[model samples]
Target: MELLLLEGVTRTIELPDAPPLTILSGVDLAVDAGDRISIVGRSGSGKSTLLNLLGLLDSPSSGRLVFDGQDVASLSSGQRDRLRGRDVGFIFQQFNLLEGRTALENVMTPLLYASGRQFWRRREIASAMLDRVGLSHRLTAMPHKLSGGEQQRVAIARSLVREPRVILADEPTGALDVETGGTVMQLLDEVARSSGAALVTITHDLAIAELASRHFRLDHGVLTPVSVHAAEGLIAVSGPAAGPATDAGEAS
Candidate 1:
């Protein structure tokens, strides 16, 4: 199923006297359930802007964004909030956990806004999620006490606790060492697959990007398909060259 779709999506920031700065220009993408997509770009390449758009944290200046077949631009602010909380999950590079809260409490935070039985059973759900991420023993551990990899695992648990349809991971392993990052990525991919959630990861690491089934590169607000020839260690741009009408990739 097509969980998310973007067509001619453009984002611009206007300053008082200066001309408008185009952050993302005519970006088109289609993400289906269980799809793994990695987007690579350097700093200031609008990678975070795209992630914000995908996670419903921000809207495009011009164009359409569809989530679960509904036009997001048409949704009321309240409706958009509900949709984002219920259907979309985000894992940030900073491991945005509540500093004073325990790992379990941080994981249970999302369920506080849930309805009915879910809200009441938040602890149980959070516990199971943490366990799934191999952090069962760290339920009472504070964010400061956990290592970087463990903190990221806690963030991952929190992201998947709602069983969201899509997972938006922005530089999820950027703060960890290479070996630890690899392990964290493996756990992330495994959990996403088992839960049947589409994974969209944004990062500058090509090795990490290669883990996804499809890859794209964003430069100066332009998005393009990237074909990685593993054997030759070559990365090639495949279609659309530059624009919002560019194709992302085939769905697995």
Candidate 2:
């Protein structure tokens, strides 16, 4: 049931008259169907770079990356685009909803590229997904009128409507209050579980990251699994990011 995997992956960029910059180095990750993984990292820690590779929007400079048993390196740009559009869903911190589109219409956007039944039933499917996220009454509400939490709910419904194999949420609750964020995370976890899709959440918030069954920390372009211990008003992590898998401790 492994949906996406990375082994010794590295991402580097070239600069004119300067040494090559490496964003990620020897990063290893395995994502399976229904898996819940949280990756915590600060800004400029290469979390975004890793997410792009995971979503098939970018390829690694080196190493093996496989999606559903196919080597991503062998696929053409067109093939990669089609696969990402069909199987990968993204939820952003800003919600990224269409400003002029209604909740239902925003949710239906992904299906616009689909064929046959999905394309024809786009409205139906999107509406149902909104209902699933407890936004049935606000289906026609414009993004400008919705609260931050409500807007994020709409984004969640939109991301899940396609039943993607993998969902990438980049700082999904960054803009909401703690209470609203907790509620949204609960809803997201429930829906993703019901749909059997892998959930990969990238955030700097330890409270939010702890919600996942498995946890990892990414620092200076290196990733490692960690065990989280929540104390009174504080969180303590005990694991070091190492190059090899044997050096990391997976909590789950």
* lDDT (C-alpha, whole model) for all candidates: 0.89, 0.88
Worst 10 residues of 2 by lDDT: 243-252
Candidate 2 Cα RMSD (Å): 4.1
Q: For residues 49-97, what per-residue lDDT tens digits would candidate 2 score against the true structure?
A: 9999999989999999999999999999999999998899999999999
- For candidate 1, the per-residue lDDT at 88 reads 91
List clash counts for every candidate, in order.
1, 0
Tell me how far the alpha carbon of residue 40 in candidate 2 is from the true structure, in angstroms, after superposition: 0.6
Model 2 alpha-carbon drift over 4 Å, by segment: 232-252
Q: TM-score of each candidate? A: 0.93, 0.92
- Pairs clashing within candidate 1: 26-244
Clashes of 1: 1
lDDT (tens digit, per residue) of candidate 1 on 143-201: 99999999999999999999999999999988999999999999999999998999999
